[model samples]
Target: MSAELRLASGGAPAPETVHPLSVRGLTVAYGDAPAVFSVDADFPAGTMTAIVGPNGAGKSSFLKGALGVVKPLSGEVRAFGGPLSRARRRIAYVPQRASVDWEFPARAIDVAAMGLYARLGPFRLAGRGDLDIARAALSRVGMERLAERQIGELSGGQQQRVFIARALAQGADLYLLDEPFAGVDAATEKALVEVLKGLAAEGRMVVCVHHDLSTLQAYFDRVLMINLRKIAEGTVAETATPENLRLTYGGAAQAA
Candidate 1:
């Protein structure tokens, strides 16, 4: 996609390449309390980024606000240089697993195929071709063999993989995941990391709200540290500094 245009200092029309995801002066609140403060940042394609902060730091809220899942009190967000509504097809969001109702009766393939619902529109039903696409997605996450199994019947790791497969089926250019590795097994974590890294390698944008600071270096090339407000953002080595962590995590940084 082409980037949005901006006027230069001389008022001349200058071409400016917009990042895959960009947010400016964003703030989200619940009632009178603000979860995320005015934040500004840009996420480019072909990179995996980790959004990290302490508990109650609004990492998830930041994402929700940016994606329009939760209305923000203030600010703007752009996906591929346009409003999110215009870039919906290019974006895929996998919400926090805990927020999902796993008890709902649905087969693994059924769940994966739901990703195609956007493409199918409200009037059409998923056909055999759609199921084939979903199956291919499950295979990418190494869960093709269990395609017919009930989603609730799978282990925590397997369940996570299924959702990821669902996201993959979207064929989105930018992916937003909320704590994908939170409660998965070591093997699952490794597998998830590999799958995500592969997406970035394929020139897709991958952003996740991650809690495990130890794996930051291994899993992401960039980091956006926030605590209701953005503390710092840059290459992991530059933004995940001791001082920045101290600012973002306070005493918790010492404990971690």
Candidate 2:
């Protein structure tokens, strides 16, 4: 990750918030079939947390539920002790790269600038100030040199970085990322991990959906195991044991 992207040097201190993200009775369903059921968890501020489970697990669904992309059958999601919609600016979401069309013909900078659009309101074009923020975001992801390149032409890791840059440009305190490590090189993975750690160190909250168990110990401070319902939430040492993994993966598949 680029040093320029480091949490905008010396901003006002973050408020002493109890939970950056809190979910209670977070049940999600697609029509009559439920994906997640009665899940309750709190993601503390300034921490790096990972959500992991098998292919059929509702890890991605949980993220979508938190983002309000998918309605919950029952439950509540809060950010900074308020309604999620009220705190949207403080929350950034980076979806899986597969969720986007790479051939959509946007430049890296253009893609990053999309982050500013939500704050800019409807039908307004991005200005020079927005470009400056995009540039800073690209620099943070070590992709400043490729700011003008077509996003479709970049590697998977580079694409992921661009999305992250977009999130950085949003100036959010909480980030929710899905499958950020999929199909990326080791170097890119390392860079991404560094960026996440930097975010946490700077007193931001990051929650990622990940799969690889081998790197779990090094990548995250806490892990939330989930299937249709939350299996466990705590430090890796406290919750990532063999028993928990089995519980999260043992169930049948559900929608993302």
- What are the per-model numbers of colliding residue pairs? 0, 1
For model 1, how does the per-residue alpha-carbon lDDT over 1-256 read when each residue is reduced to its tens digit? 2434556679877767789999999999999999999999899899999999998999999999999999999999999988889999889999988999999999999999989999999999899999999999999999999999999999989999999999999999999999999899999999999999999999999999999898899899999999999999999988898899999999587444
Which ranges of candidate 2 are over 4 A from the true structure? 1-17, 251-256
Which residue window of length 10 is worst by lDDT in model 2?
247-256
lDDT of each: 0.94, 0.89
Error of 1 at 15 (Å): 3.1
lDDT of 1 at 78: 93
- lDDT over C-alpha atoms for residue 138 of model 1: 98
* Candidate 1 TM-score over all chains jointly: 0.94
User: Candidate 2 residues 182-255, lDDT tens each?
Assistant: 98999999998999999999999999999888888899999999888888999988998778876777632232
Q: Estimate each model's TM-score.
A: 0.94, 0.89
